[model samples]
Target: MVFKELRIMRGPNMWSRDHHNIIAVKYIPEDIPALSAEQFHAVQEYFLLNFNDQQRSEQNTLSQFKWTIRLAALLQDKNFSHDLASPSPDILYGILQYKTEQGGVAALETAAQIITALVSAKEPVSFLNASLYIKEINLRNDFGPSTKIIVEAAQARNIPVQKGPAGYIILGQGENQQRISAARTAATSAIATNIACDKEDTKAFLESSHLPVPKGVLTEDLSHLQEIAESLGFPLVTKPLSGNHGRNVTCKIKTVEELIAGFS
Candidate 1:
């Protein structure tokens, strides 16, 4: 099968209104045989394990299995009627809705890949190997350890957690929702952040507050940098006027040449 387009669909659609986060795949068909019962069961179990909890009953599992087969059939031909057992068309479209769990998109993509492989293969699929592969992919794409800890902490309190666009995490719901992006929060003071972002300003603020701060000069003029370094003495640090996380920062300059190199 030749993939034409694959995208994440959000908002109201035919399959569901509330559950809008779905992966839609469009493809130009090739000769694909019907999936065997064992292959179908394997694919069903794979999706359930990765996307949904195992606590779901046999009836729920069967329902999901039917849905999976329907979508799989549609991928080979949209016009192919499951009831009539008609021949598949030359073009097809498939949609798979996924839960907003830890892996989410990665899990959905892995399931799709595994299902396609199983559909075309002549032998039984190794679910263990497929699961391991998906686990590695999920680990690579998942949030950092710190972020995961925070998310889990929120979940422990029965707070609703959602993964927003651009890797933001939304905690709670409706009026109580709190969006956390990286280390910043909605209540984070912009004015204070600006002052703290500028090393010179931060140093000045600290000095004014009778707090210990290193003596440093902030200037775009590199010509007088050597003179300033001489006055401040050896073991100087050079950094951008406004920077974070040690970016564009050079430290431990004990000589004029080292200061110049640090500035450069």
Candidate 2:
């Protein structure tokens, strides 16, 4: 069968410091020819220089290495062929799924498809090096039905699943893409489950528990915002009711325009 190039892109979670898994593009052997030797060497040097069998202490470096190694291996094995009598062509579509945590279920599924494709095509595919990450699982927020689909799919195949801070990273991709704001829902779920929510909720929850909240209410109307501001104090904060990361959320609104923008 002919080798087909593919690319898939995704975003990251907001509240988490790690960038959400951003892009999972795929390339064939020929694609690498376009990359200068310097770029190739840089890739090689990074994996070779950092990391050992020891567990990682720093999250940023750890996640970066895991993705780099996995991507390089997948690309190297692009031409791996499978036999004719095996099964469906869908398996041939090898995916390099980007994730925000160490052990990515989607990335594993992608790898599994490649193996299945090879087996059906009569080609040999083997697991190279599998690693794990310690992922923080928050309770409360519902993943809708999609989470169930992903979990079930992984389990049905008996694919090994491990968790970690492997795949999380925010894309600095800037204004072109829609900013992720689902963090509030995620934070609520996390707060319910015992995972620490972001600064805003953390402050609110902590204050409600025993401390002091600035007596703020979530609102979109500037008039109401001003009322709340007057009630609370001069230097009060008006922020998005739902926001993740420190990206779009602002602090200490001194003007109506800033308050309006944040609330809107």
Candidate 3:
């Protein structure tokens, strides 16, 4: 049997609410061989071999199949693990929900291909570097840690969410909705954002609010920084003004040599 197409869909796509993020396929119904109960047990048995004592992996025939697909993607290819969920499949469509960033597309494609081989009793493709491919896509598509936690929490609560421009999120429905990225909400003023982005200006902005400000002096000279460090004492934090995600940040310098090395 030949499989024609695979599709990745995000959100309330005519199927059901539970199928928020899904990997979908549309094919002639007869294309899929109706797996016998015994055949399914064999698949589950292989699953047990792949992941020792995995739970909630046998909720239904389709769930077992998903686990088989996940087994090849995570356990065999990546040596990684993710908590699996078995949201009830759509009665009409049988679409499967996935916890995903955009990277889910690559993962599902890899896993579906592997499971297709297994179900057809074909020799499984060997030495596929699916893990590397998945990792690369994830790096490009995955949310940063703070954003991920918020998004997952929203999903768990069944709050509607959609990816907005860049990596920002739109949550809830029209009237009750809000957009956010990192700690900034949709209402966070543009000028406030500009001030925060420029840490040098942020210090002054804080001072205006009667906040106790850290003493800071800007200088390009390494010798001037060393002199300042001597007065400030050890256990210092240093960062570039244009700091981007903790890059080039050196914390807790105990010795002058280490500080010099950090600057150098």
**Weakest 10 consecutive residues of candidate 3 by summed lDDT:** 85-94
Q: Give the winner by lDDT: 1 or 2.
A: 1
**Which residue pairs come into collision in candidate 1?**
none
Off by over 4 Å in 1: 1-163, 167-177
TM-score of 2: 0.27
Model 1 is weakest, by summed lDDT over 10 consecutive residues, at 77-86
Candidates in order have lDDT scores of 0.57, 0.38, 0.61
Ranked by TM-score, the better of candidates 1 and 3 is 3
Candidate 1 lDDT over 1-264, as tens digits, reads: 334565554344554344454555554434344456665566556546544524322332223323433433333222221211114555455555543333344544444555566555543245465445545655655556556777767756666666788878888779888998654678879988888777788888899999998777777777998689778998888888876545577887788888888888
Instruction: Report lDDT (Cα) of residue 173, candidate 1.
Output: 75
lDDT tens digits by residue: candidate 2, 36-115: 34433433343344332232222221222233335333333322211121144233233333332223333344343433
> What's model 2's overall lDDT?
0.38
Write the residue-wise lDDT of candidate 3 on 1-264 in tens digits: 232444556656655545567655433433455665655655555556545546544434445344544553462233332323334332212244444554555565666665666566665443235556667777666566667778788878888787789767888887999898975787889998888778799998899999997776666678876787878888777777765445587887888788777776
Which candidate comes out best when scored by TM-score?
Answer: 3
Q: What is the descending lDDT order?
A: 3, 1, 2
